[model samples]
Target: MDKLTKGTWILNTTKHIVDVAQKSTELNYFETTALAGKTGVFLSKLVADKQEVITYEKVKKFARESSIDNNNRNVKMHLDLLKEYGKVDYNTKLTEVEVYCFSNEDAIETTADIYSNEIVDEDEDINIYSLEETYNVPRKREELVNKLVNNGYSEEKVNLAIKIQDTFGLIKVADNILYNEYTFTGNEAKMVKTISNISSSKKKDIEEVINRISNNQGLIENKITSDINPEIVKLMEGIGLIDGITVTSEIGEATFYTSPHIKGKGIKEKDFSLADDVFHKAKILLSCLRFGQEKSTYGRGKIDTRTKMLNIIRKLNRGEWLNPCTAVGQDYKLLEVDGVVRVRAFGNRFQMSLRQKEVGILVEKMILNNSIDTTDDMGDICSLEVQPSGIIIPEVRRQQMKPKEIGLVKELRDEMLTILRT
Candidate 1:
């Protein structure tokens, strides 16, 4: 009972009930119920203060001292009323009492706000930029901006840095700087070396020019007179060393590199355009099929096989020829003639002919067979209609398909079919 004296009244209603009960000559039934409600509130606060179990004897004693009804019947009746209103634990026995906290809607909302404010205050003190200073980076974009600004970097610089981070990747940039190495190869290497010999002031100019180029979508006037050495620019333009970038005396245009390009060569100059197109199509089709398969119950080995096939296609598109051992569960020989690359399958179980042709058909057939094999029915896809885009395999009809799966199937099927025909 002494423990209740230390408890703070969180709700103002507790005071109002006491004042009204004191002023009234005699409390009616309604006033008695109100007094019980106030007692319940006090009991909850007392439990919160104790931070331990409250016994029925202690609660009953506290109620008597507080000038409320001390009779066992009245106390039990009020306790049951509190339980009915969800103010206290409904399962609380007569011997033991457990106060339910934040039981009121208002109390729950107020508690939530208090917790939210505490989290915000703690976050405000954290410096989330400059991993060297903070030891961690903020995951949120707004916090990242604030942290960079606090680290003495201008907003423009922070914006540009974020763009670079997004483009080349933060880890890649860090690796290059830490290792004191360049990722550029072939003609790009030469350009880097040439730029390295420039004066410090000129380097700053080049940096500004690059920033402008990035911001303007690769279109900018050659304004950096000192930074951009005319001789180096002319040399780069003459040798076709710059890919996805063009510089004129009046205007310079730049584009991000989506596909790998060799120095001194453009994508149009390569004779593997047909193979490239077919390979891209096959990749899309396979990716769609893999997505569909993942929604259903798929074996881990089948997923691994699908991922391997995608990697092979990506490597081939990057101008790297694959040996038979590099392929997944199949033997392949990559042959390049007159800049046209063709993949020939050796020991192919399905195709009898050993003749080497375009890699598109081989890839398509390999993926199709692999997909069919993983399914329960061996000939399930055999009856599927082959359209110009690709084969339309029926989806496994099951209640397990979620809304997300439905959307994925529709999108992949549409894109896959479109690419297969082309």
Candidate 2:
């Protein structure tokens, strides 16, 4: 086979392995971390050999040689971002995800600093900050509020500040701890409703946390990422074997540790060769096992519906409602956001919205029940707790079209239709 065709076949092969590995890891937490760390090193070496810049073609070449599939998208995405944003100051606005994806430490730090910057008090603004900065400032809103009170910021002001911070950005709070980062004109509340981390005040013992998480059904599934198990890490660290070290995460009674082993020589091992080996081994082992597991067990979706519903509400602060699938196309194009949204991939396919789906089901229910006798009363939501199938068709009357219904449907239909077109 020629080079291009050979590379495509190689990528196709790698994708299958990755898909299987993602599925089987039950307690495969340690493995993925090792995989990431090792992969980072491997990529870095390749970059170093090429004088520090890996183009899309080079990455494709590497993808073929390395037998890894995920980097394909990362390479393209990073190149696009670098082309668009260029080299910028390190800030927290960019996520760890974007950081690792790009293999750009400067970019990662720029984004990190942006996210980690402290929240300002009520009065401050007119500075340019990212939605990332806003969402992450009040990361642990309740805890930050409590911390503010401890800082003598006053319970009344601190609580109110946190509430606003949760909805607004860090710059918007009237009183900010990040005084150094000031602008001429104060324009706080830069963005609204961004995904930031949550801080939990109620510290649970490892045993307590594990028990709580285990018993909470979908609560653990929804709130906790499969990649993490904090309780497990704590337990492992508490054990005497590994010491004088650092840990990145602990999930479900599993702990990840990395530290140089001290020897008789005052300056023991400075290199992380041992740690590197261990990490890669853990990753491959986990990858194999995770690849072996059943889909239902691995998937978070199989959790108890009630628990899933409750946890999602608490986590996202909103209930999920599915709009009925009036048209279930062979292809689904999910609408991630409205307005000018950046999408790496776009095409005709199935569309989905978490809470929006419920509305469609309610509409379908009205139609199926024959409650909607006329087209003018076409606005419907089909809530199907009763039906197992996800086929939620709206109850709009096909018999006749009211002027108002036609206009409304035209607008709404276009919205859904736009996603399908893409």
Candidate 3:
């Protein structure tokens, strides 16, 4: 793991449930904050009203107006969560208790300053902020505690510091293993929280395995799950962090664990600059790769439908024409209806191939690389979600092609086809 510098951890901001739901459009500051529920609304008001310095009495008033639980304890708990996020600075030692809200950057800097100011004499060297540098890699809690104790800090102080940082979401403890929460981003934070809340003895083992696999990418399922606990692999797959796909060829069958995040290495921007029909067909195939039914007439009873689909995609990628009646059967019909494959009359038999070769290559890259960007032209999302059984079910949405863009696509397609035929 790379070492992190203090105040330079590049912390990722968490999305409230509302933010995730309404991320399609730009939101004003107040709307963004208010939609996060009472805490967001409270922070919005504090910032909007220039309440840089606040009091507990004023906090209670805001809580009542915002329809929060509004009790002395609940309000303070909310305040603490906000303080941990570096959204507010509250002085615990003051007689009157002051809460300060600075600009986004200043709030974090101020929080670090506040923590630094409150440290005891013996704990001058290693504070919560400096801990980011050391705890970049996940470690068992006892291991971390022992490491810190060996460095001269009291066990009591080390534990207290860990708890405080955990409360702020800076450090996360899952399965009794301490993880730097800054290591996760976007929906990954939700996965971390889910892991934290679940009751399991295998979580520590799961983290270790994930750490190992992350270091060595492109391992097969058997290689990963053979020695480790099956339940742990199932849980990790269920949470959508790790996934595997079984691909079949004439030679044999093997399953490879693929990264959920796709890189789209061989795909280019011009690949999407083709005809709208080609783009739309590619979009359907990508969606089918994620949302299509898992069991079908073509695949074996025990094999996954995705594996069957990938086999067809692999054949198409090789430019071999398939006969709908003999070679691919009903699978071709399903993809034809989905607009991902083209079925046309060839001599005396019906033939099927991908709608466009370029589009087929795009799908191939998506499967091979694991991450591709189609948000602009295809409206297909790169993120994935899986059931506890490890079946992927990504959200589906389609964008309508603009009239002007449609003509451009047609012109480009004609030009490319003419050049290729020559």
The lDDT of each candidate is 0.31, 0.25, 0.42
Q: What lDDT tens digits, residue by residue, belong to model 2 across residues 1-422? A: 23222222222112223323456532132232223322332232232111223334434443333334536465444334333434311233322111122222322232223222324222111111221222224223454455555645566755543443223222222223221111111111111110011122222332343333323211212233354453333221222111111111111112222111211112223421111221122221111111111112312222223223223223221323223332212111111110000112224422232322222222222122221122222121211111121110001111111223233333332232222222
Query: Which runs in model 2 stand beyond 4 Å of their true positions?
Result: 1-50, 53-77, 85-104, 110-143, 146-256, 260-422
On residues 1-422, what C-alpha lDDT tens digit does candidate 3 reach at each position? 12112222321112111223345332222131222234543443344113445456665765564445678787777677667666666667521334445222333233234323432343323343334533344566787788888877899877766664454344545446555422222123333454454344555665666555444333445667778865555434432345444433333334444333332446443432111221123434554353332322222221133344456566776766553343333334434433245556655445666534555665566555532223222121111122112211111000111122234333332232222222
Q: What local lDDT score does residue 164 receive in model 2, on the 0 to 100 scale?
A: 33
Model 1: pairs clashing at backbone N, Cα or C within 3 Å: 218-254, 388-421, 389-420, 389-421
Best by lDDT: 3
Q: Which ten contiguous residues of candidate 2 have the minimum total lDDT?
A: 390-399
Better of 2 and 3 by lDDT: 3
Per-prediction TM-score: 0.19, 0.20, 0.27
Better of 2 and 3 by TM-score: 3
Model 2 global lDDT (CA atoms, 0 to 1)? 0.25
TM-score of 3: 0.27
List candidate 3 stretches off by more than 4 Å. 1-224, 243-257, 267-325, 345-350, 356-359, 366-422
Order of models, best lDDT first: 3, 1, 2
**Which candidate gets the maximum TM-score versus the true structure?**
3
- Model 1: lowest-lDDT 10 consecutive positions: 379-388
